[model samples]
Target chain A: MSFINYASREINLKIVYYGPGLCGKTTNLQYIYQRTAPEAKGKMISLATETERTLFFDFLPLSLGEIKGFKTRFHLYTVPGQVFYDASRKLILKGVDGVVFVADSQADRLDANVESLENLRDNLEEYGYQLEKLPYVIQYNKRDLPNVTPVEELSRLLNPGKVPEFSACAPKGEGVFDTLKAVAKLMLISLKKNEK
Target chain B: MLGSQSSLVLFDEEFSNITSILEKLLVEANAKALFLVDKDGQLISSTGETDQMDTTSLASLTAGNIAATGGLAKLLGEKEFSVLFHEGEKDNLHLSLVASRVILVVIFDQRSSLGLVRLRVRKWNEELEKIFNSLEKKAKEKGAGNQSFFAEITDEDIDNLFR
Candidate 1:
């Protein structure tokens, strides 16, 4: 849920990066952390296993400067994408304002991407939210890798809803900011439309 | 207001009441710090010795911790695990759910005991719940009457942030 602190003149929104395991959810966050200016970002916290897979979540707090005298603070989180981490994933979805589904753009991982997207929809339903109504976007990640699925195919499968989508090689930072900006803009627009 | 897209608005009067309660809890419990964070991990307000602390991370992690434990509660057929305590070599954490909407986090150490902290919290939780309940009710009653502060923002204002 978005938090509006009138006393502090701050607006806080939660956005979750979600997809199947190794789809570059954490990598997306790491890249954002690396590129963000020191004053604009807070410490990124990753609750990961010893092997570096996300165990619970990865959190990065960012200041998106000020909009109309209110400091717009966005807390970016990544859910553990492993199959058995479904419960943890559901927990992270609570009060989320937007979502980024980072799909691995490889031929073989198509099933994982589909399953994860289905899982995302189901989990969202449990929270009384429909993915269709939420501020959501998809990132076709790992576009630089050989054997990557065609962007058209990825879009045909994932973007049936036709939300803003991007193709990115997260480690190289391609489309990273573009993806972030798209979803953040969608969120602001949604807030405008929903607010009284 | 409990919907996913809904917002929790903290106006000045409610904010002052919350901060005063936090400050009172700080001295009454002799705690190092007190943080009133929404279940979503947004830090509503904090008091006491937090200058050296990374409260942003703390708030996020604490909410995550509570969430994980809450998941555990479901498996065992419970409503929720409303209270959690973590003991460290020096400082101990006392986290409890307040009004099911916010988390009350108490960071204490050798200067305080769990029994005392819990006692004070039990009393204050009632007061906190009243404030939050009224806040939620007010938000609902205000409904469409509340205007969007961002109504004046334009596309240029958004695009400029990226530039």
Candidate 2:
């Protein structure tokens, strides 16, 4: 949830990165953590397993300068993308302000991507939120890899609503900031609309 | 759903009242710090010595810890876990739920005992609950009014942040 603390002159917003298992959700967060200026970011916390796979979630708090007089803080979180981790995913969605769905672009992972997207819709519904109404975006990740699905096909399947979409190779930081900026912008716009 | 868009308006009066209560707890419990965190991990207020601590991370992690514990509580047929204590080698943490919407976190060193911390927290919980209850009520009643406070913000202001 976004907390507007007038007393503190701060605005805190929560954004979640979600996708299927091994789809580079954590990589997106790690890349942002590395590139963000030290003063602008907090320690990145990853609740992961011995194998480095996200076990629960990954959290990175970032400050994106000030708006008006309030400092804008964004808490970025990633859910465990494995199928069995559905319960953990549901918990992470609580109070989410925006969502970036990082879909695996490899052709073989298409099923996993679709399944995960459907799961996102269901879980969001459980919380009384409609994915269509929320500040949302899609990232076609792993674009650098061979055998990746065509962007047209990916969009046809995943970007039906045609929300802001980006082709990202997270490990190398390509489109990382673009994706972040897009969602952050959309989230702020949504906040303004919500206010009205 | 209690979505993030719910405007949490903390007036100066409410902030001062919460701060005083926290200061009192810090003094009576002989603790290092006391933090009021929303269930979503936003730090509402804090008192005591915390210049060296990363309260942002602390608030997020504490809320995550409490959420995990609350999930466990549900599995065990409990509505929620009211309090949790973790003792470390030199420091300890006490987490409790206030009004089921916010969390009260107390950190201490060997200077204070768990018994004393718990005792002080119990005495202060009722007051904090009343404060938060009214805060929530005011937010609901003044929802549109609060929006007007930020109505002055324009798209240009938001875009300026990205620049």
The DockQ leader among the candidates is: 1
Per-residue lDDT of A1-196 in model 1, one digit per residue for the tens?
8998889999999999999999999999999999999999999999999999999999999998988888999999999999999999999999999999999999999999999999999999898999999999999999999999999999999889999899999999999999999999888888877874
Global lDDT scores for all candidate models: 0.92, 0.90
Clashing pairs in 2: A1-A95, A1-B4
For residues A123-159, could you state the per-residue lDDT of candidate 2 as single tens digits?
9988788999989999999999999999999999999
| Candidate 2 A-chain TM-score | 0.99
Model 1 per-residue lDDT tens digits across residues B1-163 = 2433568988899999999999999999999999999989999999999999999999999889888888899899997899999999999999999998899999999999999999999989999999998998887787566565666678888887778
Please state the Cα-based DockQ of model 1 relative to the true two-chain complex: 0.67
Location of the lowest summed lDDT over 10 successive residues in candidate 2 chain A: A1-10
* Interface Cα RMSD, each model: 2.1, 1.9
